[model samples]
Target: MTQATLSADRSDANANANAGAAAGALRRIGAHLAPWLAPLAILLAWEFAARSGVLSTRVLPEPLAVVKAAWSLIQSGEMWADVKVSTWRAVSGFTIGGGIGLVLGLATGLFKPAEIALDSTVQMVRNIPALAMIPLVILWFGIEEQAKVFLVALGVFFPIYVNTFHGVRSVDANLGRARKARRRRRPARHPHHVSGRASAAVEERAAKRDARPRPQCPRRCARRAR
Candidate 1:
């Protein structure tokens, strides 16, 4: 074969391989999507059946009827007012609560003494449901909007704090080893495996006496960092 024909043959093989990989991925996605599709299809069928009176709209409203109810609520100014009030409360609470969680998480991640002292208790308390706290929050802050905000803020705090605390307490034991290794060799590279292994090996070996021994290092170095 001519060199160009050989190259074209290799490209066609690569294209076929890529096509097979894509087909495999598409099949997996379709498998995952199948279960969800059944209920969705049923809902559409129900909606069409209800509108046509194969099912009675009188007994159960057609999908469009439900939409009309929702649309009418939207058309009326009252729905917007309620929405605005709820949005205001949720935004205020989410912002304040999420901020507190992030700060506490960062603090906990950074400090070991803080993590050991506080995290066990925090984890234990996180099991308590937020709904259970609503009564206590109301008692402390009253039925005012502040009560909701307080409840949400407390709800947001502990888990984030513990996660942050643990993150800060761990890692960096391998940093020096990594730095020294950079002077000798990288992990055994598979140059023939990549695009340009031949030229790279020639250039690297020609200049250096790869005569230096690589330092003794353990694969488990990352374990010590924590």
Candidate 2:
């Protein structure tokens, strides 16, 4: 083939490859954005309805209006103050609830007597809705920060308790057997060493449970290879 013809063919091939790459990138972008399409459409419809007077501002304000109000609150420092108070209440509640739950869960999971005494009561309380206690909470704590904190604590308590109890209970039976065997072999060994080993095993199990495999993007991988 002539050199000019060969060069022309090479340029055409390069252009085709570039176009294919741009198309692939667009497809990937569209795929990523697909999940947001419905929400975006809804927002657009809401905005159009509000502007067209189909929806009353009194009943439902425009999204832009809400954004503006939030911005105003932020500028006035009211938003940050409210956020600080709310964060404090939530953290206080979670700390109080989570501490009790962890201690009780460990006790009940490890000792049969503690389980028999506490588990039934805890299960019964867990079945009761947090809303059910609202009247009593109001009467006892009144309309103060304490009431809000108590409600938060009540909401936080059960999940922590249940998860901790189950996690401790779910420790491998083989590990427990191994611990016992080790104690029998070495009668003079410190008890803390065995307990530390058990704790390590629990931590390892939790780490494994929380370790998730990240998904690879094919486009990114192909680009990296090139």
Candidate 3:
């Protein structure tokens, strides 16, 4: 076969193989979503119940009713304003508290002196329930946006801090072995493989060596050729 034709055939094969692989991946993902079918069925049942008044409309609104309410809010622009406020509060709070937690976690994980200085206070604060802190939070920040942001930040901080601390501390123990195992399983290199230019140079040198006339004893030289 011509080199160009052979290359075209190989390219087509590779494209087909990639398309098959993608199809198989999508099928597997669809299969994994089968577990979600039960939850979907339950949601349908809940809507049916709400529509038939088997469930009190006051206690639990119909799904359609909720959707309509949300749609109305959106049409009125109230939803957008509320979303903006909530988003601002959540993002600001998370950024402030998460940053602090990350820094503290890193410091405590790495340095004994920092741990000794800060860990006790953090643990004590973490143990106190958020509800219990509301009165104090109100006293400090008052009933304002600051109070809401502070409360959200406080709620978000401990989990991030604890998880980060543990992850940092256990990283060598957990991830180090996995890293080594992956390295060990890497495919072996081809012993005969060489770059195109190098292989060409090697072939040229061998051709020259073979073509060169070697000086030999006069008796042996003709016999060797024969």
Candidate 4:
């Protein structure tokens, strides 16, 4: 081929390769972004529909109005206070209830005799819905904040108690057996996995040996085989 012609062909090939790479990259980006497209389209449609009077503007305010109201609440600091108080209540209840449940559950769960003794009563209490107990709780603890906290704790305790009791009672025997087997196998553990690798090395060595011709078998064994 002529030098200039060869150079022109190489430049054409390089340009095609760059274009193909760019197309591949664009396809990958589209694949990654595909999931968000439907949600964004729906949101846009909903906003336009609400604004265009196809939907009730009062009930389904435009996204802009919702954003404005949220911004106003934030500027006035009501949103922050509300978030703080609610978060405090939730975290307090979770900590108190979760701790109480874990301790009681572990006690009942770890002991079979205790499980038999306490399981029925706890299960009965759990069957009664928390909302139903509100009246009784109000009468006993009043409407003070402690009443709410106690209710939250009680709400979390029963499921943990019953589940823990049953879990300990019904644990698999094979797990214990497996633990014992592991203890027995602890020695020479290196040999277990390494044996396979060692066998692979031996096979490779045998392949190398077989590649070359070997001396013939002894006459007596060869005759018997024949």
Candidate 5:
């Protein structure tokens, strides 16, 4: 082929590739945005209804008004102060509750005696709704920050504990059996050495399984807490 013709063909190929890439990127963007379309439409309708006086501002203010109010709060620094307090409460509660839940879950899941002693009591407490305790909580803590923190902690505790317990229990029994068999076969090695290695492997597998449910726990806890 002539050099000019070859160059022209190369340019056409590059253009086609770029077009294809652009189209694919647009498709991906559309896919990501598809879920927001309904919410966006609803917001538009809400705004129209409020402006046209079909909806009462007292019942549900227009989106623009809410945005303006939020902006005003932000400018006044009140929004950030509230956010800081809320964030601290959530973090402190999550840390305290999640930490204890994880430890107790691990203990119960790993040891038969611990499970026997604690699981029934934990389950009983878990059955009681957090909302039902609100009256008692008010009476005890009197609307103080400690009451709020305790409520948040109580809300966060169970999901983490239940998920962790189930995750540990879900670890394959065959894996544990295989490790035991390997330890038995290694009779020449010191008993503690072989057993220690086996236990570590088993615990590692359990730990991985335990992590799988954790991302889900936060969502569940947050919904309940709210």
Candidate 6:
């Protein structure tokens, strides 16, 4: 082929590759953005409704108004201070309550006797609404920082306890059976058999399994697929 013709063909091939890449990238971007469409539509409708005088600004402000207020707070430094205080409170309460819940959850999950003894009492406490405790809490703790922290801790406790308990309970029966079968097949684990490489492999497998996305409900899966 002539040099000019060869160069033209090479340029055409490069252009085609670039166009293909750009089209693929756009498709990927659209796929990522598809889920956000519903929320964006809702926001637009809300702003339009507020602007059209159908909704009172006092009762339900415009989305833009809310954004402006947030920006104002950010400029005034109040937002940062509020965030700092709330974060400190949440972390303090969560740490204290979650620590206790973890201990209790493990104890109850592992021991049937502990579950029988403590589970009923914990369930009863959980049944009582946090709002109902306000008067009693005020009477005893007198609306101090301790009372606020206690309320936050109480709010934080139940979810942590429930999840921890379920997580311990969710240990696969098949895994236990498999372990027993292996033990029976080889009555003793030799030092060579229990090598660092084998242990590391098991741990890495576990980490990857844990990192994998969990199965969603049928409806959610369908929605996401769309």
> Which candidate, 2 or 3, has the higher lDDT?
2
Off by over 4 Å in 4: 117-226
The residue pairs found clashing in candidate 4 are none
lDDT of 1 by residue, 15-57 (tens): 9999999999999999999999988988899899997889988
- The lDDT of model 2 is 0.94
Candidates 1 and 6 compared by lDDT, better number: 6
Which predicted model would earn the best TM-score?
2
**How big is the RMSD of model 5?**
25.6
CA error at residue 87 for candidate 4, angstroms: 1.2
- Candidate 2: clashing pairs of residues: none
Q: TM-score for every candidate vs. truth?
A: 0.49, 0.75, 0.59, 0.55, 0.69, 0.64
Clashes per candidate, residues 3 or more apart or on different chains: 6, 0, 0, 0, 0, 0
Over 113-178, each residue of candidate 5 has an lDDT whose tens digit, in order, gives 999999999999999988899999999999999999989888889999999999999999999899
**How well does candidate 4 score on lDDT at residue 30?**
99
Pick by lDDT: 1 or 4, better one = 4
* Shift in Å, residue 3, candidate 5: 14
Report, for every candidate in turn, its global Cα lDDT versus the true structure.
0.76, 0.94, 0.90, 0.83, 0.94, 0.91
User: How many Å off is the CA of 223 in candidate 6?
Assistant: 99
Mind giving the per-residue lDDT tens digits that candidate 6 earns over 9-45?
9999999999999999999999999999999999999
Clashing pairs in 5: none
Error of 5 at 196 (Å): 28
